[model samples]
Target: MQFRLVKIAETSKKKQTFIFLAAILLALFTTGLFIMFLGHDPVKVYLSLVNGAFGSRYRIEQTLIKAIPLIITSLGIAIAFRMKFWNIGAEGQITMGAFCASYLALNYSYLPRPVLLSLMLLGGFIGGSIWGIIPAFFKAKWGTNETIVTLMMNYVALKWIIYLQYGPWKDPAALGFPKIPNFAENAILPKFLGLHIGWVIALFLVISVHIFMNYSKKGFEIAVIGESVNTARYAGIEIFKTIVLAMFLSGGICGLVGMIQASGVNLTLSKDITGGVGYTAIITAWLGALKPHWIVLVSILFAALVQGSSYIQTAFGISAASAQLLEAIILFFVLGSDFFAKYRLVIDWKGLSRKKENKL
Candidate 1:
């Protein structure tokens, strides 16, 4: 008896409704306890969070700033998940891409803006693809554990960036800081009005990937493989090829995200350049069920929570660390909702009647 990925079966309407209600009640009750412990009103805190997230144009922009990167990287993550491939190295891949873009921007800042931008993006794609393909290749050729390989590679990337900042890539003007120089005018991406044009690029990529995964024959092959690797083999699908392609594309996309965040926002590279977008994107993928449209909604919602955390710090005399508790709570509920929506937990399996077994 081997464990396997279960394709959660559809349940009756009544059961579906019950699960939905259960998920909501569980989230609310848990959050309520947290509020009580903190000596805060749960309803007031919830309202404050929501208002802080959507209260003004500035807040909206901040939310988009968070959501845009998530949308792009999570889409890449979603692609691999669809093929049942766990690619957890998007963070390293993103860092490598940022490293490449930063290096090029520093060296070739004299080039025309359009050309420099294009090259930065290309550098990002290549850097990320190379990083992504390593683990994928080993997994395909030698049946190596991709999860371990990718996780280890993240530290490698982190150390590489650190070495550069401390040695060759150090900015002369920054006396002691471990950071790169401000990108040249040509090295920077354009801002459309106030919003980074990179957001537009992210939006287009989301739509394009959505269409690619849903309408393309290659997409069907991925879904088949995810459903059953044996079925894919029986259907003559090249499993290794799929793994390599998916991982490459996944890493490449995350790499692009790195470039955009660097050139479009940070405008320089730091050791901790990627922040936590890599991990957060995974949550976005799961919350979205790898669906393109749903991903958008979930990303924005999560982004709102992030923004709201800051608001709580400012308006309610709460520490940022404490505000983060609310975010964790929300994420737990969202993920838990997905679980309940899919699987019915039998807490007391032996107590179930034979009729329930027949129903399941």
Candidate 2:
């Protein structure tokens, strides 16, 4: 018998929810087997993961800090994805944003705190927007493959940061070490409660994106373009303008993550400022189905997974590679479920019979 795949035109919300939950359960079960293979009790390890992520106020705060960058970067990615534009340059955009913000912070240390911080934010946004626009312009003007261009730009941005860190921007205070100077007090973000104000910014962006994507005119144009460029043009939507604007917004939001990380978490610009959040955000954006509200939930869950994985390394003596493997397995199953939700496998009896007849 031959096997074939058929797309499901539609699935009920309840069924989709059931499939999602089942996927998670299956993932957990499968991961448990792996844990057992490693001679650890699965149930205890699971509990430890939960505790590591949210057992106490401090743990929860740390999870939130991890989620902040994920949430912001995912939102940016979702915007571009909504228009079917593959923006893989978030890492570069983020680096450029931090570099731009640091320029102002390092040079204008004499400015008042609020003013310098605001200028830094603007600079970060502009930097990312400019990076995003480069790919958009090429795609709009010459039909360039955006995915390749954006991916290549990421390395360019990384090298730029590395050059600055080791060359001109190197802090002379460090004795023969490559490091950028830390941001002045005026450049750092203030904390609200125990966490930096980034959490508040994340929440604000979540609400704003939901509104923009669902209620705004430009949002409608983006959706239409994603569906069909021809349809969008027939509907009088400006394809070039929409693509560029959407990407501008996407990259700028991602840039904010850089600014927040540099100013709040690292307190200085570095080659590792992104911590691979740009790439991770793509997973969150897709898993969240490109929805702003859903992105928040997905980002938080992902953050918890990362935080818990780190904790298990110390708490249960689980090696880092094993913990990472556990995460990969879970993500694989969960992503597979999304595919199954939209399609089904079937035995092609007719095709098999025809093949047998031909052989006979």
Best by lDDT: 2
Q: Model 1's lDDT to the true fold?
A: 0.83
lDDT of 1 by residue, 269-344 (tens): 8887887788788877876778888788878987887788789878776666654455466567766666655765
On TM-score, the candidate that comes out on top is 2
Off by over 4 Å in 1: 1-9, 12-25, 322-360
Instruction: Tell me how many clashing residue pairs each candidate has.
Output: 0, 0
Question: What TM-score should be assigned to candidate 1?
Answer: 0.88
Give TM per candidate. 0.88, 0.93
Residue 21, model 2, lDDT:
78
- Clash pairs for candidate 1: none
List the candidate 2 regions with Cα displacement exceeding 4 Å: 1-6, 321-327, 344-360
RMSD of 2: 2.5
TM-score between model 2 and native: 0.93
lDDT of each: 0.83, 0.91
Error of 1 at 81 (Å): 0.9
